[model samples]
Structures are given as structure tokens and as C-alpha cells.
Target: MIKAIGGYFGLEMSRAESLRYPDAQYFQSARACFYALLIQGKPSKVWLPYYNCDAMLGPLQRMGIDYGFYAIDEDFTISRALRLAPTEWLVYVNYFGLCDRQQAEVLRRFNPAQVVLDHAQAYYSPPVDCLATLYSPRKFFGVPDGGILVSNVRVGSTAADEEASHQRMSHLLKRFATSAEAGYADFQAAEKSLEAFDVSEMSQLSRNLLACADTPTVIEQRNHNFLTLHARLAEHNALAFDPSTLNGPLCYPFLNERNDAVRPDLLGESVYVARYWAECQGRCSPASWEYKLSRLLLPLPCDHRYTDADVQRVITLIEKGLKGD
Candidate 1:
């Protein structure tokens, strides 16, 4: 039989919690938020980082907005800085919640109104003073479907399909009932549904679910989990990031040239890690650091649900992997 460990970490609320107010406006997905903002801003074009998912291209292409790409250093730092004209916007990702507010303050070099910050990985990081800040709660929580957009620009309001969350919840349910492996099909189905995207408000189901969230627990537990895992991996880890930079992290990103071996080693120990992106495999050369890093960088599990034993188990597995056990 398949096994399971953690449950949903989204907002960390229990079943007994009452559904109250959902404090912010939400959308169908981060991509939908991008579409809505594009409609309102009508920018001459957008400047997106070369290190990005092609999903953003969907909305920009649909809107017929002129766009171009820029590059980032291995440290994920902006390789080249540009001050776009008033009619254009620059999109920046806070990466793994490691880019703190002070780091994001660099955008002030451009007009705040021209920046679009993607907090898809930085859910708890507050919105910087930018034209728009897009969030993917599913990236940080157990929610079946939802994305939040905080923007200075105006977009048309649209009521979202309430049933969408139900269609996507099978995997989440199966994970709770049995093991995450049992929910693989539903998870794949949920992922496939994103391409049929639209601009809609967050569903009441999601809003009610979000209302039950315990904000403080979500922040504290995740921060603690990240640090605990980092402490074990820091001396040998490839990320040049400072541990103090973590706020509410998505995962413990571990860099290993042998990620191919590392992944199966952990999986054999019932600890499954994730590959951040598959889109980069063909676009960049295999010999390049970006390509190899993209291919081998393993995002380790350190979400809130894991225990001290769980963390120790991961450390043990990694050590075993390093030793080629």
C-alpha cells in the first residue's frame, strides 16, 4: 500500500474552525491575474526574465502585448537592469521567498507603477509597492484552486465558477485519505485544467476554506521547517542564499549534481521531492549551469506538516544518498 506523511499546510486551519471573512480578492490562478492586469494596464509590452515559465507568454500573446526577455545571474539576481518607459511594465519574481522586502526594494529604481511582482513563491511576503503583485496560494498551501492579485490598476470583475475547486480536489482528498501516490491521476487532471483559464473571482468554497486559515501558524511552522532543514544542508548546499532570508518558504531547495540519484534515494525512503520546472530542459543547452541546475536542483519537502522525526528522516536519507547506500 502507498504511504502518506503530511496533510494540507494551507493556512494550517483545522476542521472545527469557523469560516469567517476572507481578507483579500482572489482569482482563478496567477495566470488569470496576469490576464486581468494586462487588460487594465494596456502596456506597450512587458519585460520578463529568461528564467521563467512559458505560461506567462499565454496571457501576453492572447493580449497581443509586445514583450521581450532578460536574463538573471546564477544567483538568480537580475543580470541586467532596465528602466522601461511609462507605457511598459517589468515583471520580477521574488523566487523562493528568499528575496526579502529589502531586496525587492531594488525595484524602486524604476517607477513602482511599472513593476509586476510575482509572489507565487513568496506568498507571505507582503506586496511591494508595484503595479501588481500576483500570488499562487496552491504553491504554498493545500488549497485545490486559487490565486490572489494585489494591483494598483483596475480590471473588470468576473464571478468565478464555484465548481472548479471540486474538480481539482480529488488528489487533495486522496492524499488525506490514503497516500499522495493514490491521488496522482487527480493531480495530473488538476494540472491539465489550468490551460483552459479565465478571469474569475475566487470561488466561495475557496474563500470559505481560506477564511478558516490560521495565519500565524502558517508563517511560524513553515519558517521553522525551512530553517531546520537548512541547518542540516547549509554547509554543503549549493544555493548561495543566506538562511536569514527565509520567511514563509515553499520547500528546502537542495542543489546536488547527483539530483538524479538523490531523488530516487529519497523516494525509496518514502520521501518524494519535486523538480521545479520541466520547460527549461530543451530551451537551454545541457552543458550550461542553468540547464544542469534546472535538471538536478531538488526541492526537498519541509512544509509545515512534517515533524522533527520527519526532518531527521530527510537528513538521514540525504546522507545515505551522499554515501551511495
Candidate 2:
């Protein structure tokens, strides 16, 4: 049976000459990537950061893998002083993609083979010699439902590509065509749809879109936008890091005493900023450093989508919001 030659056309997409991690395994979601690793290693216990989103606990709970919470210091370092058993792993997040130094310290202190580097926010940060490194590319790019896992652990290949990628595209397309306000409903729907926690291969649609990305340009733009924000607000920001170590950070995390008040003010002015993790408040005590970080850290937009002028506008609005103007 021969197929018709060029009968109809489909979506046209460009193929990139190279990808950041060409040999990395692709999964439907970051949690699925972690699940793949957990299933392979069968770790006896795992430790997660208390200052993280509850979504991360999904794979572990589903697999019946025992897990405990660990505390993060004001500087995002692991505060726990416990040694891991032979079959236990510790998950450390590259918080706001601004903790390379802390990540290096963790690698130095802990056994590299028992560490899980959650680079969900640190897409541009390369993987170190660890048990596994997981990345949720959707956080940084326009693609829908794709995750990258780099590790020595062989979670053999799969052909069962996720089928819901097209359905989840509504929000990305809507937001691109119109404004964020217009697409808010669809965005919420898209997010809710991914709660199923399906562990499958990355969908072909998402993989193609990711391959089409101009990664070099995006990285350059994101770094520039981040520095643009940091240059003006470094003195006021409580979270300190060397600007030289930054590599396409997720956002410029600005911590201030007035963050709780200014967040709503910025929203009122149509400048939406995201809180790191509101769920941490329910888990960690109010006086804990992690809880304080959850309450005051404003992850201001510094991705590749905006220009320097746009960032300056956000800075001006932040200043006004702080002043309660």
C-alpha cells in the first residue's frame, strides 16, 4: 500500500541544528521524569524541600515511596544536618535559578549519586554529576508539557507519546494571540488538565516546538533582562547572588518587607508578579525562614518575552507600589 505523495499539508516547524541536551531523555512532565528515576533506582526514602510546590510530591505518593520534608535557610541552603542512608536521595531545587553557588555546595557536601537536582526553574543551568537532573521546559519556553531528564540511570526509551499536548495548546496560543488577561481562563484550564500526572513520553508536537526554539537568542535575551532588573534593584533585594554566575534565570527574585503589600498593588496596575510558593505557608510554621521567603519573595518577570523598557516600567511600578502611590 503506497501513500499519496504530498496530499495535504500539516503544521510547518523548523528543526534546530542543536538542542541544549540532545541525549537527555524526554518525559511528559518533570514529575514523570522524577518518577522514571525513582522507579529505576527504587530509593528507600527521599527528602524534599518544604518550600516547594505540592505538585512535586505527586510521583512519590503515587509510587508509595517514602519521603520527608527538609528546611531551607534564608539563603536557600539546606538547613538539615542529617546524613542520607545508602538508598536515599535528597532533592534540591535551584530556587528561581539563582542558586548555582548553593547547588555547588550541596554537591560538595552530599554524595553526588544520591542527589536529585530539580532544575525546573533553572533550565539554562547545566547538569552536574548527580543521581538525576530534572527540568520542566514549559516553565521557560512556549512549549506545552515536555520535560528533560539527564542522568546515568537508564529509564529505557518509550514510544507512548502523550496525547493531550494539542488540547493544552489553547492557553499558549490564546496568550500569544491576545493578552494574558484574556487567556487566564484557558491558562487555568491547561494547568488543571496536567494534574492527571501521566508518565509517558513527551508528545511529538511539544518536542517539535521545542526543537524550533531559538535557544541562543532566548538565553541572551533572558540574561540581559535579568541583569536589567538586578542592576536597579540589587540594593533593595534581600536575596543576594553573584550576577556573573547567572545563566538565563527564570526571574529576578526581589525580596522586600513590603512585598506582600506591593504584590497586590502591582496586580492592580496590571503588572502581574508570581509568588514563589503559597502552599509552603500551610506546611512550614509562620516563623520559619522558608515561610517568610514564600510570603515576601516576588519573582518578577525577567524572561525573554520582555524588553529593557518593559523591565524599567516594571521597576517604576514596583517603586510606586512600595510607596503605596
Tens digit of per-residue lDDT, candidate 1, span 135-157: 88778666777888887576875
lDDT of each: 0.77, 0.86
**lDDT of model 2, residue 83:** 75
Give the top-scoring candidate (lDDT): 2
For model 2, residues 192-244, the per-residue Cα lDDT tens digits are 87777655878888888887878788888888998988888888888887888
Worst lDDT run of 10 residues, candidate 2, spans 156-165
Clash pairs, model 2 backbone: none
Stretches of candidate 1 off by over 4 Å are: 1-24, 81-83, 101-105, 285-289
- TM-scores for every candidate against the unseen true structure: 0.88, 0.94
Candidate 2 Cα deviation (angstroms), residue 313: 1.2
